[model samples]
Target: MEIPAPRRTRIQQEKRELILEAALEVFSTNGFRGSTIDQIAEAAGMSKPNLLYYFRRKEDIHETLMQRLLDTWLAPLRELDDIGDPLTELRSYIRRKLE
Candidate 1:
């Protein structure tokens, strides 16, 4: 029989975050073409099987990370409001990004 899978979305999200954080650190030093699942798993402090349980493949993780990165990368621009003072809004946007 197959083992039951984890149920909590929170748990899965946490583990996914761990994996992404680790992958980012590893990928920063070694480009995607040079990185591997083993490196990401070791950095994430989880076994290879455990990492795979959350992310099926390195490409999946990379794609997820890239999507999240793009979302955040555009957040400040998304916040721009024509109704707000240009300088003030720009300052607020820069502040948000710095934090």
Candidate 2:
């Protein structure tokens, strides 16, 4: 059987946030295949080994960023005002999404 992962402390959470922010900036500029663990580590102001301590590989960072992007990007669609005229609401939703 697999053991559950330990809960992260506040410092761990903050470091993860730092890593994510750096990953986002690097990934946005370089795209996935073009970016490297060293690049992300440098951007985060941490060593590559430290980054790997938090996440095992580059793919882990990409996957986390994509999941976060999807959750945040789709939040606008979820909040469509159902009480309004459907067409108007949809147009607003589209506009918001585009923005």
Candidate 3:
């Protein structure tokens, strides 16, 4: 059996994160129909092929980012429960939003 090599540098990891962040910004601003791999690559300061290496397709990138956003949005709501007072819970929720 063969094993893949791990990424050798923190820079590569950072670059991947940058690419994802840029993709999210571009996709959010332009919507899926209007965004292109070239645009995302430019926004990420990377080549189209490099972007493709991280994400096989534009739809794949969009889906991954959307799922991430949904997870983030749902996390706070999940923290709310029936145990807290309404006004205090609302204030805590507002603070979480600002945070």
Q: Give per-model CA RMSD.
A: 5.4, 3.1, 3.9
How displaced is residue 58 in candidate 3, in Å? 0.9
Global local distance difference test of model 2: 0.93
Candidate 2 lDDT tens digits, 23-96: 99999999999999999999999999999999999999899988988998899889898788999999988898
Alpha-carbon local distance difference test for all models: 0.94, 0.93, 0.85
Residues 67-99, candidate 3: write the lDDT tens digits.
888998777777776799988888887778778
RMSD of 2: 3.1
Candidate 2: TM-score? 0.75
Off by over 4 Å in 1: 1-8, 82-99
Residue-pair clashes per prediction, in order, are: 0, 0, 0
